[model samples]
Target: MQIQLEFPAALATVLGMRGLLIDGGGTLRETFRRIADEYPKLGLHLFDESGGLREHVLCFWNGTNTRWLPSLDVAMTEGDELVIMQAASGG
Candidate 1:
């Protein structure tokens, strides 16, 4: 399967592109693990020391927040889209 991943500009600087087409078929967690393997720097920004997604990092899986999903083990399909962003903060 080929999944589409979109990143914010700041993260894109690390990825060298705002969007990426990843080839593989697996659960969401596995796919992210693959990305981390390929881009360690970007992984730092996306995952915490425990390998879980950082609190401030928001990932939308096909427009629905991945956090809202039942599990990160949700299977990914061809053409699935994932949009990653940093949650806004401060007043």
Candidate 2:
């Protein structure tokens, strides 16, 4: 199955803002790992040494936050749309 990936903000600098077609047929974990393999930079920003999402970034799929799901373990199917967005904060 092919999934649609969209990157936002600084994240988009690494992977332009648009739909990226990705093949995902394995477990979600494996699929994410595959994405990392394809774009090593995104993985760097997505995780820290402690293994948590960076405070500056968040992920959403089809208008729903992935934080509510298992994230890397969330199952993916064809035509699934994902967005990698940077969280906003200001004083």
Candidate 3:
């Protein structure tokens, strides 16, 4: 299976690309682990010290926020897209 990844500009700079295609199957967590393995620097920004996703980072899986998902262990299908964005804070 292949998953698509979309990153914000800041994070994209770390990976040298705004979008990517990665071969992944199984749980979402496992897919992320693979990404972390390949792009450690981008992973730093995606996950926090506790190995959990950062509060300020938003990960949308197939158009739905992963945070709102029942579990990170949710199985991902081929062509699923994961978009990473930094949460906006202000007034």
> Which candidate achieves the best TM-score against the true structure?
3
On a 0 to 100 scale, what is the lDDT of residue 22 in model 2?
85
Q: Rank order by TM-score, top first?
A: 3, 1, 2
All candidates: CA RMSD (Å): 1.3, 2.5, 1.2
lDDT of 1 by residue, 1-91 (tens): 8989889998778868898888748999998898788879888889998888899999999999998988899889988999998899887
Which residue segments of model 3 deviate by more than 4 Å?
Answer: none
* Comparing 2 and 3 on TM-score, the stronger one: 3
**Which ranges in model 1 have alpha carbons more than 4 Å from their true place?**
none
Candidate 3 — which pairs collide? none
Q: Candidate 2: list runs displaced more than 4 Å.
A: 15-19, 50-52, 70-72
TM-score of each: 0.90, 0.73, 0.91
List lDDT for all candidates, in order: 0.88, 0.71, 0.88
Tell me the tens digit of each residue's lDDT in model 3 across 1-91.
Answer: 9999999998667868898898778899998888888889988888888777898999999999888988899998988999998889896
lDDT tens digits, residue span 1-91, model 2: 8887777656667666544788877656666677777877777877666555667767676678767775567677777777778888896
lDDT of 3: 0.88
Candidate 1, residue 36: CA error in Å? 0.8
Best-first order by lDDT: 1, 3, 2
